[model samples]
Target: MAKDIPAVAAGNQVRSVAKALMILNLLAEHQREMSLGEIAKEMQLAKSTVYGLLATLRDFGYLEQSPEDGKYRLGTRLFVLGNVVADSWDVRKVAAPFIQSLVDELGETVHLVVLDKGEVLYIDKRECTKSLRIVSQVGTRLPAHCTGVGKVFLANLPAEEVKSIISTKGLSRYTKNTITEFHLLEEELKQVRQQGYAIDNEEIMESLRCVAVPLRDYTGNVCAAISVSGTLSRFEGDELESIVSLMVRIGREISLHLGYRA
Candidate 1:
């Protein structure tokens, strides 16, 4: 379902609340600092109106002003909100031990990720004992098209929403292997949905390989993904297939722990 932006107040209460939120949403989507004029242009609002709204949001700690560039971005309020949302998920707690176990058994990095808006948010991660490793920390957010967990999540989204996200997010190339074309990514997602798994073949980082499986909720809704990542040298053919199978089993186990029936 599409999220409803709050109704704009009419008549005397036309305080530009809707426009202010639109600006915030734009900034959030960009995931980068934006200047007041840039924000005004993007929002199609008067410079004065954008400035006033930004000032109000800054005063309330909902937006932060950078000292170096004087651009604004999401503030401490978002961090607080993110923490609240992260903590509310009982699945994170239930899956942490299993994630650790997977890391120990496979000797590779294991991660649990959930879709937040159009981005993939890493909720938990376990590091392997290998001397050399692929380092992905918890709380890291990445573009859905560039990572295994994100692709699996994207594979489960409605077609229109998938198009909407791709249109808005833009397929950024993180590495030479990254899928930067929308049509290619759509085809890849179709394969992922059909196979019930996704792979990141050095897309996000050079010489890294990862396999991911979706975690379904009680309603059979794809709610999260579990992945194992390591250097490319360690994953190939049977070894790669083994990790995929392991991830699928672990993912289903975690999903069942979260009350998933199937």
Candidate 2:
């Protein structure tokens, strides 16, 4: 009947959306580039139908088409959206217990941070009963060049991206230990990569020392960092080594919860 026209159109629209989602899932399952013909054949849909859905997804940046092979793959927009979802439900929930354990065992403060807009954004912090406490608080931003957690993140980023961050957020000196020169900071980051950890030796605040390790996601990419902080006297000789080793183990365990393999 004529009255059934709108209902039929709505059903068609839902089918189109379902097909589009199926295409995305297929790409994810294969984890490789797929051609239009291949996708159409795999989905058992007509080439024209697949083409329309692919075109829509590509236009919205949900998919990318290679110019050389004309194959399609997931796009950066999906990564951005995925990170937003992960931030809301994954990292913080996964890291909380480990962070608390570190504070309890080490008798020092611990912090979890992520790099945001070339700055270190503190998302969580656990304090010990020590008389001296870190001045930083959760939801606050700090200079990436001067903090141990910040350096761990910056060290993992691309050189060009790091340089861009330095250009935008100049290396303002907080203490004499702060790395103010680009060449020196580059060397510091290189050392961090080689050593698998980073340290802040009175760089941000006088007499405060921090040891930090990077946290990876399921993709094996460094997504965040965790740091243990205390006074200079507490982090020396064999004590510092023990802290570093423990934090590294804790970092790995937290990363595993986020689906990181290694």
Candidate 3:
């Protein structure tokens, strides 16, 4: 017996497949188990049609129906797939092209760093063609209070965690511009969160300025930070605002590639 399924006319997209995906999206949006009738009503489809799609999805492990309530929710398969995606997001590999683009455009050194044990651990660095260079290397660790990248990470931490890091790291002063007091550092962090960026204003090395922004992961957590570094002359006057805007844009793009939504 031949089934009389209607052939979809628009670009070869199967109607059933599209409906099935829509059902999944609906469930995700609701973020709760849904009855067949509820799903059908929300999808504006017949109960029989929605039931068929739900049953197919349940059998395939993409959805689960409760024995008690008979309501459908997302299944462990999505979790497994999510893990696969997370595992593949090597931040260095994901951020490499964006960092290079920043370096090429701004003619400033760029760095990628993560917070490790309450300190900034530099994982990647791209240098510009300028003769005057910022002396930072991959695998170098610095106090989170003095560097732009470090403060960006710290700004996202809980107050207690920030205090704990301060207790351990001691806010060592590298230059006169370095924030050496707990109260002052707290104020600086508050400003970073407010402005969505941080600046190392000759704090770590005199005459070296850097602007940094946070990189987020799928769960909207700040997973790392990226920065553009140059001499105070390069970061001075009108060029400073342009560099800040470009760094923020690049940060968002790189974060998007890592599954961040906003």
Assess each prediction's global lDDT (C-alpha) against the native: 0.86, 0.90, 0.89
Q: Tens digits of per-residue lDDT for model 3 on 1-262?
A: 0132335874687988878878878888899999998988787788998889999999999999999999999999888986786457499889999999888888778999999999998888898778257677887899899999999999999999999999987988899999999999899999999999999999999888999999999999999999998888889788999999998899999899989996
Among residues 3 or more apart in sequence or in different chains, the pairs in candidate 1 whose N, CA or C atoms overlap within 3 Å are none
| TM-score against native, each model | 0.70, 0.67, 0.66
How many angstroms is residue 198 displaced in model 3 relative to the true structure, after the best TM-score fit?
A: 0.3
Best by TM-score: 1
lDDT of 1 at 50: 82
lDDT tens readout by residue for model 1, 63-135? 9999999999998987898789877888788888889889889988888998998999888887866724665
lDDT score at residue 91, model 3, on the 0-100 scale = 92
**Tens-digit lDDT string for candidate 2 (146-257):** 9998889889999999999999999999999999999999999999999999999999999999999999999999989999999889999999999999998999999999
* Residues forming the 10-long window of minimal summed lDDT in candidate 2: 1-10
Ranking of all predicted structures according to lDDT, beginning with the best and ending with the worst: 2, 3, 1
**Per-candidate clashes, comma-separated:** 0, 0, 0
lDDT accuracy of residue 180 in candidate 3: 95
lDDT of 2: 0.90
